[model samples]
Target: MRVEMEFLGSGTSSGIPTIGCDCRVCHSANPRNKRLRSSILFRVGEGEDERRLLVDVTPDVRMQALRANLSSVHGVLITHTHADHCHGLDDLRGLYWGGGRERLQLFAYPESLAQLRRAFGYLFDEDYDYKGIARFDTHVFEHEPFVVAGVAVTPIPVVHGNMRVAGFRVGDCAYITDTNEVPDTSIAKLKGVRLLILDALRRAPHPTHLSLGKALHIAQQVGVERVFFTHINHDLEHDQINAELPAWARLGHDMLRVAIEADGRISTDEGGGGVAPLAF
Candidate 1:
């Protein structure tokens, strides 16, 4: 079995080319510099029988889906409930109506789930009786492993400043974001990961997000075969930051796709809009 992953968006909360900024990276001619809020799509199985799993429904998810040609999503794995990460829940209604009529499965930590319910009360309100609302079969899990769509998913717990968030490990690949601290236990869980998609906010240190140095340390500690940094801010230009990284690591961009083989080998096919594949 192979798991194909796509970087639907790879920008920080503010996104690249941020509003009212005249920085070099924002004005760079490179298409890779243009980004949306962080999100990823995981495709398992093959051909018409494939199952699409989304990680983080950002406010840009609707546009992300359209850009990626995503027709339907079978499940969603939420890292946290931050406005940038989960505010696009309402957009799932279009997928429900146009593609899969069945309810989508949503996996999240208890804290994230609580926050989501609070933020989107109308969706969870059975008595509201509103039609055309997005629906999900919510499943709450802790820092444990669970199965979704026949794939084993292990939730790695990490600290995002004062709050706890989840990083998911499925097969040979792991996707982690919005985290500053990866405890020893979580590090142990990430051991031997073949492909790692991690949060690398910027060059400077942050209270709630991992800096480029911290992200590289974690990637080296885990000994991942290939690593891509996500949740990037405008401070780092795609080409400039990638030039500083080791051959095994690079800055991820929107629409970059990675193929994870069953034998733990990984290959990348960058989005064809002139962005090269981050060296494996």
Candidate 2:
């Protein structure tokens, strides 16, 4: 039951090299610093049975997909309905058609789905005309375990600002993004997880996102074998931060691939400039 998770984009809302900002990380020569909006794709299973679950379709999703050479997407899981997390959803029309599926399955909490319905009335509203638009068959889950394409997934509820969002645990890894706090109950749900991809917005604290110090604290509490910080802002330079971090943790970058084996072995590419899907 091993699975692989790929950091499609690791930057915060504005993304790296954000417009009009002349910060050092933004202009860093290292490609790792050139991050896009936060998102991840989980490859569950292998060969023909493989299912790729896309989490948080950011505004940069199109570019991220192209960079990763993702030939298809099996399903989409939204952490929340924030603009950066789900804005690029419409851009996935081409993927839906290209994958030759009748409709893409979308899994999210009730509140987020309601927001999606409002945002994309054309896609979900039965009253709207169905021209040639790609459809998303929405599935709702709330603080429970669900299955997608035969893989079991546990939803971990976390607080983001004034709202609650979901983080998912599939196999041995749990991904929590854009959340400043993970409740004690949710931490209990993530007990056996060996790998954690948690949000660490920047070196400084933010109201809604976890700061580096807090992220480290949570990772220690989770007692994960390894952790990679995501939802990064440009304040922390990639290489410099890694140099400062302990052996168990490092800042994640765009296109980073982490593979876990059934026996609990974990391996990574440091993004290795991203490897194309096997279909390529």
Query: Where does model 2 exceed 4 Å of error?
Result: 130-132, 275-280
Q: Give a tens-digit lDDT track for model 2, residues 7-68.
A: 99898999887898888988877778887889999998888888899998899888888887
Residue 202 of model 1, lDDT score: 95
User: Across residues 1-280, which tens digit of lDDT does each residue of candidate 1 receive?
Assistant: 7887789888999888788889998887887988789989888778876878899999988788877878788888999988889999999887777555778789998878988899999988878887888777899999679988887889999999989989988777889999999999999999978899999999999999999999999999999988999999999898778888899998999888887866656879754542523211
Worst 10 residues of 2 by lDDT: 271-280
What does each candidate score in C-alpha RMSD? 3.2, 2.8
Candidate 2: deviation at residue 143, Å?
Answer: 1.1
> How many times do residue backbones clash in model 2?
0
Which candidate gets the maximum lDDT versus the true structure?
A: 2
